[model samples]
Target: MVQNPERRTVLADAAIEVLARDGARGLTFRAVDREAGVPAGTASNYFANRNALLTQAAERIHVRLRPDDATIAAMARSRPAPSPEVLERELTAMYHRLAVQQIDYLALLELRLEAIRRPEIRAALTATMRANLEQNVAAHRESGLPGSDVDVVLMYLALSWLIIENLTLPGVLEGYDADRLIAALTDLVAGR
Candidate 1:
C-alpha cells in the first residue's frame, strides 16, 4: 500500500506517546489510534505490525527531539568563534530545553530498553543512534564548537547519561548544580 507520510508521522507520534506512557508491551495499533484520536484501525493502516510501529516511533522520537536548524543557526550566530564558555552555555540551554520535554525522553528511553529484547529493533535503533551521533558531530564542527569528532562522541555519551539520570531521578545529584555540572562537562570536552 502507498504510504501517507503525514498520516504516518501522526500515527508514529501517537505511538511515541503510548510508548512513553505504557512502555513497549503496551503499544498496539488500537492504543496508537486512541492516542492519536483517530478512528480504529488507523494506526494499522500506517504500520504493518507492532515491530514496524515501534521502529517508526523510534525514528519519530529522534526527529522530534533534535534541535531545529533555526535554533542551531541562532546558537552559531551567538558567538563568532565559539569558546569553551559559549559552547557550555549552548549545550546547557539545549539540554535544559530537552529536560522540559521529559515525556519524549522517557519514551526514547523506553524504546532503548525495549530494543534490548528485540534484536531487530536493537539493530535499527543502533543505526539510528549512530546516524544521530554523526549528524551532531558534523553540526558541532560546522558551528565551530570546540571539539573533535571523538570528543563530541564522548561528550554525547556523557550528556545522554546525565540528562537521562537527571530527568528520571531528580535530585540524585543534589550537591551539584546544573550549570556547574555542565561547566565540568564543557571543560572535559574542551580538554581544559
Candidate 2:
C-alpha cells in the first residue's frame, strides 16, 4: 500500500497525545482514532500493529517536542563561546521551557518505561536517543559551547534528570535555587 505521509504524521501525532494522556497500555488503534477524531480503523490503516504505532508515537514525540531553530539560534547567540555562566543561563532557560511542557516530557518518560520490556522498542528508542545526543554534541561544537563530546553527553543527562525530577515533584527542592544548581552543574561539566 502506498503510504500517505500526511495521514501517517497525523496519526502519529494523535498517538503521541494518547500516549501522553493515557500511557502505553492505554494506547490502542481505537484510542488513537478517537483521539484523532478520525473514523474507526484509520489508525490501523496507518500502522501495521501496536509496535509500529508505539514506535511512530515515540518518533513523533521527539520531533514535536524538540526546541525550534529559533530557540536554538537564540541559545547559540547568547554567547559566542559560552562560558560556564552563559551555559548555566541557557540550561536554566531550557529547563524552564521543559517544565512548562511537562506533559510532553511525561509522555517521553512513558515511552521509556514501555521500552524496558520490549527489546525492539528499546532498540529504536536507544537509536533515536543516541542520535539526539550526537546532534547535541554537534550543536555544542558548532556553537562553541564549552565542553567535549563526553561533557556534552554528561550535561544532557544531568539536565534531563534534573528537569524530570523538578517537573514531576514540584517544590521538592525548594530550598535550593535552580539557577545556582545549574551553575554548579555547568562548572562541573565544563571542568571550570
Candidate 3:
C-alpha cells in the first residue's frame, strides 16, 4: 500500500532480519521499523498487515538470494562442456557463493517454517521457488552443463538439504568439506 517503492523494500528487508533473528512471533511493525532505522510507525504505514509483511518478506528474500546475471554468465562460461570436472567446479562455485550469504539463507529457512500455517506465504514461496527452479534447470540444460534434468532435480534436493544442514546444524557434517560433498554429487550425476 505504500507508494514509496524503495522505502517499502527497505521495510521488507528489515522484516526479513527481524523474522530471522526474532522468529515469527517477534516479527512486528515496531521490530521492522527499528531494524530499518526508520520512524517507529514506518513499517505499519508500508504494510497493510502482518500477513502482507510476511509475504513481502518472502518476495524480498527471493530477490536478495538471486545471483546476478553476470555471475550466472561467468559460471556458464567456467565449464564450456559437459563433464564431471565441469559439474564439480560449477557446483562448488555455487555452494561457495551461497555460503557467503549466511544471513539471507537463514532468513529463507525461517520463512519456510512460517509458511507452514500461512496460506499466503506458502503460495508466494511456492510460486517464486517453482519459477526459480525451472529457470535454473533450463539454464543448466541449455548451458550444456553436466547432468540430466533428473540429475538437476536430485541435486537441487541434495543441495537444498545441504544448505539447511550447514546453516541449522553445522556439527552434523563436521570435518567434512562442503565443496567435496558437492563434488560427490557431481560424480553421481555426471557419470564420473
The best candidate by TM-score is 3
Candidate 3, residues 126-182, lDDT tens digits: the string is 888888789879988887877888889898888888887888899999999988889
Q: What residue runs in model 2 are displaced by over 4 Å at the alpha carbon?
A: 74-78
Write the residue-wise lDDT of candidate 1 on 1-192 in tens digits: 438888899898998899889988889899999999999988887777788888887777878888888986776666656789778988788778888887798889988998989876787788888899989899888878798888888778877877888988878977878778889989988877
Full candidate order by TM-score, most accurate first: 3, 1, 2
lDDT of each: 0.84, 0.81, 0.85
Question: How many clashing residue pairs are found in candidate 2?
Answer: 0
Indicate which candidate wins on lDDT: 3
Give model 3's clash tally.
Answer: 0
RMSD of each: 1.5, 1.9, 1.4
Root mean square deviation (Cα) for candidate 1 = 1.5
TM-score of candidate 1 on Cα atoms, chains taken together: 0.93
Give me the runs in candidate 3 sitting further than 4 Å from their true place.
Answer: 77-79
Query: Residue by residue across 95-190, what tens digits does model 2's lDDT show?
Result: 777777776787888889989998777877888888888888997787676778888888888888888888778688878777788888888877
By lDDT, the candidates rank as 3, 1, 2
Question: Poorest 10 consecutive residues of model 1 by lDDT?
Answer: 72-81
Instruction: Give TM per candidate.
Output: 0.93, 0.89, 0.94
